[model samples]
Target chain A: MSQPVRASLWAGLYCPGLPLSAVWDHQPGIGPVAVHSHQRGQARIFQAGRIAAQHGVRAGMGLSQALALLPQLQSRPRNPAMEQRALEQIALAAYGHSHQVVLAPPDTVLLEIAGSQRLRGGLQPLLDQLVKTLRQQGFRVRCGTAVVPAAARLLARVGQHADSPERLQHTLDALPIDALGLAPGKQQAIIGCGLRRLGELVRMGAPERARRFGSALNAELDQLYGRQPTPLAGWQPPERYRQRLELPVPSERSEALLFAGNRALDHLGGWLEVRDRALTALHVTLEREDAGNPIALGLSLARPGFDRARLLEMLALKLDRIRLPAPVAALVLKAETTLEHRPPQADLWDGRNHGDAWPALLDRLRARLGEEALSGIAPQADHRPEHAWRWVPPGTTRVCTETRPRPTWLLPEPRPCQRADFRLEDGPERIEAGWWDGQDCRRDYWIARDGRNRRVWIFHEHEPRSGWFLHGLFC
Target chain B: MPEAQPLQHLLDQRSDLWRGRRRPQARCTGSGRAELDAWLPDGGWPCGRLVEILPACLGSGELDLLMPLLAEQTRQGQPVMLIAPPLVPCPQRLHRAGIALDRLVVVRAPDQALWAAEQSLKSGVCGSVLVWHPRGRVDARSIRRLQLAARESDAPAFVCYRRHQQPPPSLSALRLGLEPGPQLTLLRGDGPTRALHLGRANVIELAVRRRQSASAP
Candidate 1:
């Protein structure tokens, strides 16, 4: 019996003009935009949209020449932060379609979808859905599928479609040697030899091709043909989310810092969802120009949080309290701490615990008022009423021993009092401890009712101090 | 699926499923004072609901009435928060009453007390929230909102209103009017209006009498 060999399938998604596309998505209908970058002290086009390209603008064209050709061409500086965020978003979208996703930078995403074809009903429908979703997310994508990952990426990059290994190989052979991304010197040498296509280069003697073009061309071809395994390090969601962004202009207003911080949080929320983690603490740093240290605003959540609205609300509160020493030129947002998020178990009848809302509110209050504003009461091991207790940070664990009923309120110091119009309801509970600390106290405690019938806890000092004093109140 | 039905039934029966909140259990938490617990519904203070406490005056043992609930909750690792308490809390006294001082949070902003209480109740981080609305007239709508918020979480909420101030139209799950001599009168609840004597033995009185008798010789 003879067995037929089955071909593995991979999908490649490429965005031709990602930098310009990201800017266009943010500032839509800004009349034919071109993303420009400084090269050798000259402004050069990094990416140009279809509209800009139609007006005779292209990548590598000098900005001055392009502007002269099309007066309506709106050139914007390339924002790497925005481009990176957009790429991460594309990778996240691909993750939903397949388990193994490889991020090819500047920008493309390759997904292993061979096994997922049957589950998704077939490759066409999956690709169709992916293209539709990516377009809806403000991206222009050219998708291609082939038998090998490298061939898929090459086909996608070149806007070619190949479904079978034989067809992919044929297309690869006919592809220009420049498609291999070889060094410019090697590519020029290969092209200068009158070998324009890969098929012509392959027909040459192997040693001759290596000695002239070097082994890079052969290595890329071998990987593309599956003669050598193309092991792509699959894109993994980052362990933490840290985004640094430069402001368009320096501003001393703290509110301006918050505006930039919010943009970072939007990306962070997406990243947290991708990584399946909840943020517990965040550090927002304002990079100041000529400053002592970066103004760091920290938010600590009582419970793990992911909601962006809540995060922004807390940030707004925190930002209001920061007094900027100098103008901030840039801002950085870091998820300083995170926890594996486990969604609260839904109750069969009561549904989910809405009690989690308080942590966010508490965090907001703490962010505005400072950590010292909130404290928990904890008991110390002293016998003196004032010395026996202390104020501790909330959430601390302390042991409390059971004793008799005690007053709810205690005075800082016992105030001298007259017994006039106050009826003594209970009397003479003697306490003789606390002699070891030199401030020995001997007192007889009593419960009294004031003229207004308010209950007060009073005590009389023994010996040297015979006067009655008010100690505490029971409410 | 057929085999799972019986398993599901057993799970439902034996499981401590927190499907929303069930009715107060028959073995509810005791009020620490035996005399007080006997008069209370479910043999103790109810859980997962708002209780309106109307004190005749400040320092009328209103805190003592809830001390047992506070102590029990803190012992179980559930925190207790007091929002805008009328008087400064003595941590030593609370610790002596078996309440963990570390588990007790006192929020002192009077204007934001109700908001803090509602947030704390909904936060589920605390076992109970004691909100003292001393000055402002809290409307029925606010009370209703608080009651609804309390029902969504496991923590019990207590709103303290001064006595003689007309009760808000919004009804809480339970209402008790505290009088002098540490007495509690049920203002409203599922049960009938009645008085409860929370009179415990005054250790001061007992000791004084004992000393006097011993000196008579």
Candidate 2:
């Protein structure tokens, strides 16, 4: 006896009401809604909500007829762009389940899960988790599994499942010829020939069927039953994430904007998660209602990571500082830059890790206090006291070889003073340099004590511009 | 002993209870000055605790007092943060004092000094944090927040108040008043309010005189 090899499995995710749901999901507590599009130059209902359907609104019905059937029916034009974006988002979500994802537009995502099934425990769990994730993202999803992509999509459209080859054969045999999704004229021709079930069509002689229905039907049947290969272009996740969410209502409150932005950020997090990348900078644009210029807020992180909570916190901080010029109608979040996420290596002995919090603290401080408010000081090899140091990013380390008895504090600018105001403690550490940068300074520096017994660095300029100036503190 | 069990339990639960004879050993980092360490209750600066330093005047050896602790921390590759110092910190001086200038983070949050200090302490990554609060504006509530944050993290936090500002009762673990002579008065801590000379001021003066004589000769 010969052993049978395991066939590859594909799962199809079908979203039946994508056109209507994609527009209605963000806006809550609205009346019955229906999506209408131009079909053969006549506006027809593409999809209708449950409430709208209850009032005799159906897909392919004229929009004027739907409104006439129920005067209170809310109708929106079908947005193909929005639907395409919605499909891509679902595909991005499915990419987390399996690396091989094929997107069938207008609303189907197919995933080859044979390789990843063991990692996800089993086929059923993977399908359940995928459906759960999509549902949580406010999409109505039905899943079906089969040995081939076309069969999986067909079963998903009919809300059926066929996991194994034997089951797939049984399911496809019982499915009617209508489920083949042939051209309308071809479907009618096949039905007219007394072909009621797919099992009968499969049992017919292949040459005769090909002669009667041309080679396309036989090829599709061969691909469906795994006899011929179904080559699909795999969908690759985009490098950048840009999601816009339409607000339910125009509101000027920052909390409202944040609430809408949180959804877009979730999608960004999911997109980044699949790519193993961290977002370093994000740009958010607020679409204003008054036709004014949109407000753009950019947040750059000190440490890059797809930490949703941290990003939200930073957004909240930015929102708290800005007064919205007008009520926002939509919120758009774009990932400006991303870095490959690398987890910090833990030390073998140290059980407690304190290194991770440093970057988070820096990010938080910069978010609230502005970027210029924090810096690390690096010593520069310059003779001028004021020019001897420069501001650097925090946590940067450099070696300084020059060791001199400089004051603990250098004043931003020297304050002119009378020489008699201070008692000289130490005299004449002359610094004459900076001629190259056109900031030449020739001053005699002294350590002096003021009336309050505080040590200060004072300087006396040479020649044409001479004055006693307090320069620094010895604290 | 059986009848006093409830009272003893209450005393143990209450952190404010002061036991005169029995002193609990606390986790500490040495101040690097023998005289000051001997005077401190914990034999050093208490770790994970807020220490409020009230200087008598600007440039009155406040930074000098913290120089040793900062140097020790930076040498160990731990970061030391200076939040809103009164003037620019000279990098050459810090390097000469054995402090790692690279590990020094200077935050200029003049209005949010206390908040930044609290966050730095709570982060636990910094070895030490020094925040210069505005004159007479350090409230008790903010101090309490800083104290709690410090207690939760290993970093020791120091809040420097302005000169001549009277020290209010705060939740600080240790409070010391500093003078130009580099003298320290233990304003609040485990021991009596005794004064101790820091011992470094005289050494600096002697070194200055020695350098002058060497140059004169």
Best by DockQ: 2
Determine the iRMS, in angstroms, of model 1.
Answer: 3.1
Please report, as a residue range, the 10-residue window in candidate 1 chain B with the lowest summed lDDT: B201-210
lDDT of 1 by residue, A90-204 (tens): 8877777788889877788899888778766888899888888777666779998878898888888887877787888788888988887777987888899998888888889
Question: All models: lDDT?
Answer: 0.75, 0.83
Q: Lowest lDDT 10-mer window, candidate 2 chain A?
A: A338-347
Per-residue accuracy of model 2 over A1-475 as CA lDDT, tens digit each: 8787767888899999899877765455677888888978999998889888887799999999999998988877877888888898899999998989999887899998988888768878888888898887878798888989988888888888787878989999999998887899998988888999999999989999999888889999988887888879999998777888777668998888777777788788788888878778998989999978999888887777766788889889888878887799888888866566766555578765555677788888888888888999888878787877889888777778675578888888888899999999888888888778888879999989888877889999883368999998887
Clashes of each: 6, 0
RMSD to the hidden true structure, all candidates: 9.0, 5.1
Error of 2 at B112 (Å): 1.4
Candidate with maximal lDDT: 2
| Share of the reference A-B contacts seen in candidate 2 | 0.86
lDDT of 1 by residue, B47-158 (tens): 6688888888877777877877787788777778888786678765666555767667887677767777777776666778898885856677778888888876677688
DockQ for each of the predicted structures, in order? 0.34, 0.65
